[model samples]
Target: MTTHSATLREEIEEMIAVGELKPGQHLDETELAARFGVSRTPVRETLIQLASMGLVVIRPRRGAIVAELGPQQLVEMFEVMSELEATCGRLAARRMTREEQQSLLAAHQACLDARDAQEPDVYYYKNELFHEAIYAGSHNQFLIEQTRNLYRRLRPYRRLQLRVRDRLHNSYHEHDGVVQAIVSGDGELAAHLLREHVMIQGQRFSDLMASLPQLRQGAA
Candidate 1:
């Protein structure tokens, strides 16, 4: 794909993430191409890329639509995500070098600034850098690739969670523990902290569920 295709894909992904493109909403290639000032070929390629990332569904006759997951599907994906993150944390604790640890600390400090500024979008992008640092610190290429793919797939939901009351502060605090455990080389503790951090349970789950209706309404 060219730069145009990549840019198109990101724009569409952003739309889906922020609810401009809702679950199950049809995505007409022609319309998208016109909207983005691109050719239909690039739109088609972009849709295919998004489909691989589990963001778009291309049907035999029905064409493409934004992928829709039920509550159960969401839970299952997050369950896998939690495990992947835990493994990354565990390996990072054991494998990261001094330089990598310092990088991770830098990422964490960036997140702190974003949290204090009450800028969820800024924090969201910064949070990606923080997690990516840990993923790279794991030092296993295959695991890093798999973890990154799933993390990108789950980006929108994670971003949405930041908008929940006090979630930004709480998330930063959670990162603090994760950083400490990894920097201390406590693999078990790091794994445990990361698992809990990634899991959506109790009130967090309720908050995410409550936010779905508003997302749908935005599309409507």
Candidate 2:
């Protein structure tokens, strides 16, 4: 994708994630094009791609609306993410290179620094890089591709969870455990810890959703 399209896609995704564009809300192509200061052609193409990604729904006459998130989908996504991260950890324990291990440690340290500075966005992105380092270290291209797809699908929800108080600190600790297990070449321990770490996010999301009246009302 061209830079314009990629930026448009990211903007739209961010808007939806932040609730600027709510689920089931229609998206106006002309408005998006004007807001983005780009032509409608790229916007239209981006919408189609977003629709394919299940971020939006495109109807013949009604244009696009944000996709709804239900409990079932959330559970399914967590299950998939748990499996993917576990597999990545398992492979990484056996296959990780010295440079990859160093990179993972560096990324984790960066995340810790970002957390100390109270920069959630920077910490979140660095956390992503930390996980991506493990994924790349797995040495399994097929697993990497599948995990990337699942990670993208869950990005919005994951980003939202970053705002939960002290989540950054807790996540850093979890990443430390994962790195320790991997560095020690304990594949089973690495896999178990990774799955637990990822699944805990799901539990947190569930608890957060339960406590949010607006979210409950929306689901109702």
Candidate 3:
């Protein structure tokens, strides 16, 4: 995809995520192209990327439509993500080299700095690095790839979690627990803490749905 396609993708994703693109609504390539003052080629390419992310679906004759997951489906993805993260933490606790441990602590410190400065966006980026450190530290190539893929799939929803009132601070404290457990080589506690860290609670789920009104709307 070109630079234009990448920007268009973000725009369309924002529309779908915020309810401007209703669930099941067809994404007319021609209209999008006209709207963006570009050729349909870029819009088409943008939809392809969105389709890959489960944010849209490209049909044989139906064009593209928004992808909406039921609440149950959302919960299921989070559960799987939590388990994967837990496994990564468990392995990293016992398997990480001294250098890896230092890197993980550095990531955690970055998160603390972001939290103290109240920069959710910074915290969000730092949080990704922190998780990636643990994922890499797991030393399981297959597991790293799998977790990274799912992590990207869940990116939008997880990023919004940072905007939840006081969520960044809360997440920092949670990270503290996981870091301590990992630093001490307590695989069991590290696993447990990491699982809880990523699992979206019922209240958090509702909060996310409320924030993204499109998520609660009926199919178009």
Better of 2 and 3 by lDDT: 3
Candidate 1 per-residue lDDT over residues 78-190, each given as its tens digit: 88999999999999999999999999999999999999999998999899999999999999999999988998787778888898889999999999999999999999999
The segments of candidate 3 whose C-alpha lies over 4 angstroms from its true place after superposition are 34-39, 213-220
Per lDDT, what order, best first? 1, 3, 2
**Poorest 10 consecutive residues of model 1 by lDDT?**
211-220
For model 3, residues 113-165, the per-residue Cα lDDT tens digits are: 99999998789889999999999999999999999988877776787788778
lDDT of each: 0.90, 0.83, 0.87
My TM-score estimates for the predictions, one after another, are 0.90, 0.87, 0.86
lDDT of 2 by residue, 1-220 (tens): 7788888887787677666788899889999999889999899988987887778899988898899867678777878899899999999999999999999989988988998998877888898999999999999999999998878877766765676677778888889899999999999999999998887445687655654454334333
The deviation in Å at residue 48 for candidate 1 is 1.5
Best by lDDT: 1
